[model samples]
Every structure is written in structure tokens, then in C-alpha cells.
Target chain A: MSTNPANHSTPVNTAAGKLAVGWALVGVPLAYGVYETLTRVAALFG
Target chain B: MGFLDRERTIAPAGFNRWLVPPAALAVHLCIGQAYATSVYKTALVKHFGASLTEIGLIFSIAIVMLGLSAAIMGTWVDRNGPRKAMFTSAMFWTGGFLIGSLGIFTHQLWLVYLGYGVVGGIGLGIGYISPVSTLIKWFPDRPGLATGMAIMGFGGGALIASPVSTALLKAYDPNSGAQGWVASGDAVGKLFLTLAVAYLVYMLFGAFTIKVPADGWRPAGFDPATVKAAKLVTTENVSARNAVKTPQFWLVWVALFCNVTAGIGILEQAAPMIQDFFRTSDGASAVSAAVAAGFVGLLSIGNMAGRFAWSATSDITGRKRIYMLYLGVGAVLYTVLALAGSSTTILYVALAFLIISFYGGGFATVPAYLRDLFGTFQVGAIHGRLLTAWSAAGVAGPLIVNAFLDAQGKPGQLTAASYQPALLTMVALLVVGFVANLLVKPVSARFHEPRPDRERPHEPAMEA
Candidate 1:
């Protein structure tokens, strides 16, 4: 249930900031994975 | 700074709801380690000298408990809200890992089940729904995208955990020989403790960071009319109690069950299926274990991507249309994967990737679908009940895949031919789900609460 708004916008993350943070959460870790997988793949080829 | 204080969680007028997703992600990413149960499965099998099935049951019990706890604790989540739910979740999940680690060290099998399976399962369920209702409330204009953001973390959670856990296990016991650093139960126990601490810290960040959207909050320049105009996207609220009584709920449940079960057809057998499908000359050699691992990784990427991509797309295409794509189009993908066989490596990879994406999409999309049909009032609880479908699929998918393969009379070095029947069976399951999705209609007005209760409802009256 929603209580009354304090009427002060906290604006913690700008729209762009929100999108950036959202993707970064997934992207940073996934990048780690991609790098890891590539390392393994290279070993397979080697 | 007091994380569990309810008053502290109220969003100010300018509170940007976007911060919520990262918070949700914090919890989900940690719990997603449950998917990486394989990271320790072999170690446990060797350490305990247990059958693979016995080791595998840890995952099963956790999954089944996830469904049960989510269904049972959903309303509690709604009443107490995400902050408390997430805090509670952190304790159980992190505690489960520690307790489970102790089980490994003690060589007690049931402790693993009790700690990881039962207790951790409770954490999984609570953590899963902790953000659903809050996200729905925050991003009313984009329910699908809101849920996708957090649920995608779940789909992607294992990506982070798998490597981290493996590295930790290795560090604990580097002298593991050819079997690698995975043979020692002590290392596994220590790894569990490491994970428990790491996850607790991350999830605490989530609980601390999370705040519910203010009452009656909406995005800038958004019009409620635009959403109300969509078909089957209701403006009415339905109690979780009444929601289960509705036909639409059952339809969505069936649809999710089928989607998950079909996806597990591959997920439950990712390694073996890949090796079997691409066997070498005269069936003497299959794909290397490394390649199979790579294939699983590829599928994981697809899975995570699908959760975001498809769920976001649902914002524009509408939830119903996306389910059509997931079920109707997914059946076609299964058929293609089955017919295409092990013909080419690229073909196999491509088809499996697509199927897995839809699988992840199915999960991320369902919460939004529930919000559409049932309203945010009880969407979390409804979503919790729906996860029971996942529990059922967890068992059914493996059984179907393994049984069909087993009945074919080959035990070892299974070929591409071994998977045809199961894949076809997956196609059939998708067909059944497609029909179920087709049957989903708007919840009838009779089930809707008469008034939109703005405050959380009081605890139920004791039945004498």
C-alpha cells in the first residue's frame, strides 16, 4: 500500500543512469564470463 | 541506515525507482548460484562416494522448496515488503550455504538437504518474489521491463557464481591432481562458507538500497489511460486468495510449467546433449568436455539475454503476444532443433541458443503477465504460486529427457539419435503449453476486489 509522497523527488538515478546501472549489473559479470569462456576456448584450440 | 525499518523504505517524490533493479539484482545474482550446483556436484560425488542422482537431489530439493516457500511466504513478502523479505532471504540463503558447508565437512548428506535444500530453498523463494511487487509498483508503465531487469539477474546469476565458486574451490585446494581441485569435500565446505559471506554482503547492499515506490507514483508524463487501453491488462486489483480462484491464473501457471519443462529438456542435459549431438567419427569420441562447457556457457548468455530482450519487448508487444511467441514460436524452435539433429555444429548451437533464450524469457515475462491479469495488489503471491510449475518442470524435464534416452537401450556415448525423441517430446509439451496460453483470457470482474485498498490489508482473522 502506498503512503503519501514526501513530494521531494529523490531522483537518485537519472533515466540514463538507471539504464546504465541496470545493464552494468548484468554486463560487468557477463563480460567476466565472456573473457573466461574465450580463455577456455583458446585453450581448446591450442 | 536501519535496513529493516519499514518507514525508512518509503520513497520520496524524487526517488528514482531505477535503483531498485540493482538492489533486486543483488539478491537474485547471489541466489542464482543454485544453478551452478554442478560446480560442486562432482566434488560431492567423489567426496561422499555418492551416486550422481544422490548428489543431484540437492538441487531438486532446493528447487521444490523454492516453489513451496515462494507460494507460502508470498503474502508475508507483500505485508512486510521487499526490505524485510530481502533481509530474511539473505539470512536463510547465506545461512543455508554455511550450514550446507558444515554438512560437507561433516560428511552428513541430510545436512546438505536441510541447509541448502530446505532452508536455502526458502531463501530462494522469498528472494525471488521480494522485488516483483515493488518493481511492478515502481514501473507501472513498464511492468514487463521492470520484472525482466531483476529476473534477468536470476537467469544470469550462475554466470558470476560458477567461476567465482570454482576459483575459490581451487584456491582452497590447489593440489587436486588430474580431477582438478574438486575432489575434496573440505574445499567444497570452505567454498560454501566463502559464498555464504560474499552473498550475504551483496544481498545486504540490496536490502539496504531498496525502497518501495511512493503511493500513487507514476513516471514523468505517463498516462494511465495508455496502459488501461491494452487488452487483458486490468486496472482492477485481485487478492492472491481470489487470484487462484480465477481461470486465467491456472492458464498462466500451465503455460509457465510447459515453458520451463520444455527448456529443461536441454538445460538438464546441456553437457551430455552437446557431446552426444556432435560425436566424432564412428561414435568413438564426442565433443570434448571443454566444448560442452562452452556450449552451456553460450546457452547461459542466451538465457540471460532472452530475459531482458523478450521481457522488454513485451512492454511494446504486450504480454499475451509474447507468450504466443514463447509458446507458439518456441514449439517451432524445438521442432527445428529436433529435425536439424547433429548435422552441423553451428546449427546445433544456434538452435539451442534460441530455445534457451525463450526459456529465460518465459521466466522474466511471467511476473509482468501476472501484473497485467491480476494487478500489482497480489502479483507477487500469484507469481509465487506459479513457480510451483517450475518445481514440477524441474523433475519432469529431466525424467522425460533421460527416460526417452534410456528406453532407447543405450547407456553410454549417446548419439544425436538419442535426443530426437526427447526433443520431439519437448515440441509436444510446447504445443500443449501453446494451447494453454491461447486459453488465457482476462480475469473476470467477479473475482476482483470491490475497492482498491490503498494500504496493505490486515492479517487474516483467526478461524475458530
Candidate 2:
């Protein structure tokens, strides 16, 4: 049903590329937060 | 036509564009509840026999974690999709409440911190960013209003949470000489459990309803290339890494930090400031603690209203213009608040409301501005990085307000008039913010020029 050539270049692929980069940026911070939370919880149990 | 036939005729991959804003609003409203944490502060402190510093710590922890979590989860929203992020947010948010309920029942401080501060904080971070990048993509032409509509919900969330939490605590009161609830831990537990269940239902609605538009979607008549040409704003489409290295990024960071630090000083101790003001002035001590609660509620309304009104205004006037208004007019209001002192209650409420509105406007307008400068490419991630400013303000704002108040308190006079000194300090911060806003120039054309020599084979052509 799609007729426009513009649809072909909608940058959906670009979205994926951006997403990969975004995830990499956040990955370290997320891991650190998880570690901090886990350690705090562990101390509670210990 | 059959229902299945009708469904097939609609865009198969793309969401109904109309549905996206409402879905964004739903998530924001639920997460916005974090602003209402102060409503529980006095009760928690009284019940637990904790000091003001300890009680304040709980909120500080939640806020610090909110910034940290947002910075971390922003990338996840970009990669995994909003659906996954929203779902995860709902679970953690609900679980935090449940755990908090248990903590209240058991009389455990650490449990409460873990439940609300860490778990719920992560939920806030994830939920906050879920709709932002998607909304910017959906409405490239009017990115300000699109992001604003969702964020406005967040600013207003406190408006709903405050009065509602107050009523619930009242209803659940054990009447056994307990200030708010029965002194028993069980009563407190039940109250938190009820709040958890309600929030879970609301947040689930948001999670299920959210969807990103199909790839390459734009408005019917809009041309992407035309947009790139029209605004000399940040449209370079740099990766987050490259964005951080640019001078424009640090300028934005300074602007956000100054704006937030100026606003939060007033917000953190609003109730005490009002009470002291009234007590020292007229002999009418009849306003009571509940009236102060109502004042906070009213401020929440202003906060929510400003998010929508000012941000929507940015669409017409431009983001830079609105920020100037927030800083310039906000500075004037702070001056009036300081000089007028407690002489007029009407003036106090009006001026406070104005300041709070600017505070809320700063938050709403920033995402649209980010989109203008950076393009939608990894904007949510960039916005997350920018929130480190908020973390700094969280400490700086409270420190400025409290330190001033403490210095005044040391005289042992301890009246509402003591707040005058703090108000003056806030005025000075706003003046600094005003100068920073003026210094913000559009990114230089040289910075926008793509070095073809350095371009990766896969990188899109830099917008000229």
C-alpha cells in the first residue's frame, strides 16, 4: 500500500544504530547501579 | 467490512499517531508521583522517631537515585524499545511499593530506603525516558509540545498524589494515639500496600498502551530536509559520545545546573518557610498544619500547569525565549519574595506559585531544546547525561536554602522572618542563572560542518 520513496529512507535503520550506541552508553552506569544496590542489600543480610 | 478487514486497512506497523501522546501522558502521570514524597515526610519522621536530617536523607536518596537511574536506563529505552522499558518500570515501581509496605509493617528503615529509594527510583528513571525519544520522532515539527504533553503529566503527578495520600492516611488512621496512623506497624503497612496496588494498575495501563510509530513515519506534508535547512539549531545528528565532546554540550549542562539549583532552594523547605512567616507576623496562629499541606497542594497544581502552559508556549516563541522568561521573570519574583517578607500572605502565595511554575517549565522545555540542538538521534541518552546537573542541583539547592536557614537559626530567634535571608540567597542564584541563559549562543556553523575526511562510511551526511 506504500507508494512514496521517502518511506524507504525513513531512518528506521538509523534508529537501530542510535539504539545500539545509546545502550552502550548506559550499560556501564546500569551495571554500577545494580552493583551498588546488590551490595547494599547484601550488607543488610550479612 | 469485518473488524479484521478494518484492522488490516490501517497502518500495520505504525501506531495510531493520536494514541502515542496519551500513552506518554499516562506513564508520566504515574511516575510524577515522586514529587509528592514530601507529603509523607513529617508522618514518616514522627512515626519512626527519626531526625529531620534522616528524613531528608530518604528524599535525597530517592532523588539522587532517580538521576542516576535515568542516566543508566536512558540507553535501554533507546535500544530495547519503549514497550520493554515501560513494562519493566511498572514492575519495579509496583514492587518498590510492596516492599515499602513490608518495611513499614516491620519497622525497618533500610527496607523502606531500598523499596522506595532504589527500586522505585529505577522505575522513575526508565518510565521518565520511555516516551521522550518516541514522542520527538512522532512530532518532529512540534517536538516541544509533543515532549511537553508527556512531561507535563510528570510535573502534575504530585498534584494527584499529595491530597490523595493525605486522605488515605486519614482513612487508615488507627486512632490509638498515633499521630496519623495507629502506632502499630501493621496499619502503616496496609496503607502502603493499598497505594502500591493502585499505582500498579495505573502504571500497567501506561505500559500496555505505549507504542512507537512505524519506521520512517513523518507528518503528511513535512519535509525532513527542509527542517534540516530551516533551523541553524543543533541538527548535526552526532552520536552521544561525539555530543559530549562538543562545547555546546557543556554550555547546556551549565544552563540546566544553574536553572535547577536556583529553583530547588525554594521548593525543598516551602512549608516551613510559610509557617514561620505566618507565625511571626499576625497573631492568627489558626492556619494549622493542614493549611500548609493545602499550600503544597496548590503549588503542585501550579507546577503541573506551568509544565503544559509554558512548554506549549515554547512552540510559538522558541525554547530560548521561554528560558529567558523563566530566568528573568523568575529573578524578579524571588526579589519580591525576599523584600516583601511575610507582610502579605497573598503576595507570598502568588510569588511562590510563579517561581514553582518556572521550575516546572525548565524541566518541560529542555527536552524540546535538546531535540533542536542534537536531533532526535540519542536525545533521550543526551538528556540523561544532562540530568547529572539535576543531581548536582539536588544537593546544591538544599544546601543553599538549609545553610542560610541554619545560619539564621543560630541567632536563636527562630521565627518565620528568618527565611528572609534564604530568600535573598536564592535571588543571587537566579541572577547568575540569568547571565548563563544570555550567554547561550546557537552552536557555531563550524561545529556543524561534517569533516568528510573523518566520516565513517556508514555515517549519514552531515546536515549543511
The prediction achieving the highest TM-score against the true structure is 1
Q: Rate the local accuracy (lDDT) of all candidates.
A: 0.85, 0.70
Every candidate's CA RMSD: 4.4, 11.2
| Residue B353 miss distance in model 1 (angstroms) | 0.4
| lDDT for predicted candidate 2 compared with the true structure | 0.70
Q: Which candidate is the best by DockQ?
A: 1
Q: What DockQ was computed for model 1? A: 0.26
Specify the CAPRI tier of model 2: incorrect
Least well predicted 10-residue stretch by lDDT in candidate 2 chain B: B1-10
Which stretches of model 1 miss by more than 4 angstroms?
A1-27, A38-46, B1-5, B177-181, B452-464
The regions of model 2 sitting more than 4 angstroms off are A1-46, B1-14, B176-184, B224-232, B278-290, B410-417, B444-464
lDDT tens digits by residue: candidate 2, B1-464: 13212122233453345566766766777777787776577667777778868767766777788789878777666776666777788888778888877777777878888998888888888888877887888888778788877888787566556556666766676574555443345555666788778777766665555566666777888877765654535656655555666666777677777778877877777666677666634544424556665566556666767887888898778777788888888888888887785777778878888889888888888888877777777788878777778888989988887787787874334565677677777777777777776766665444443545664445433442
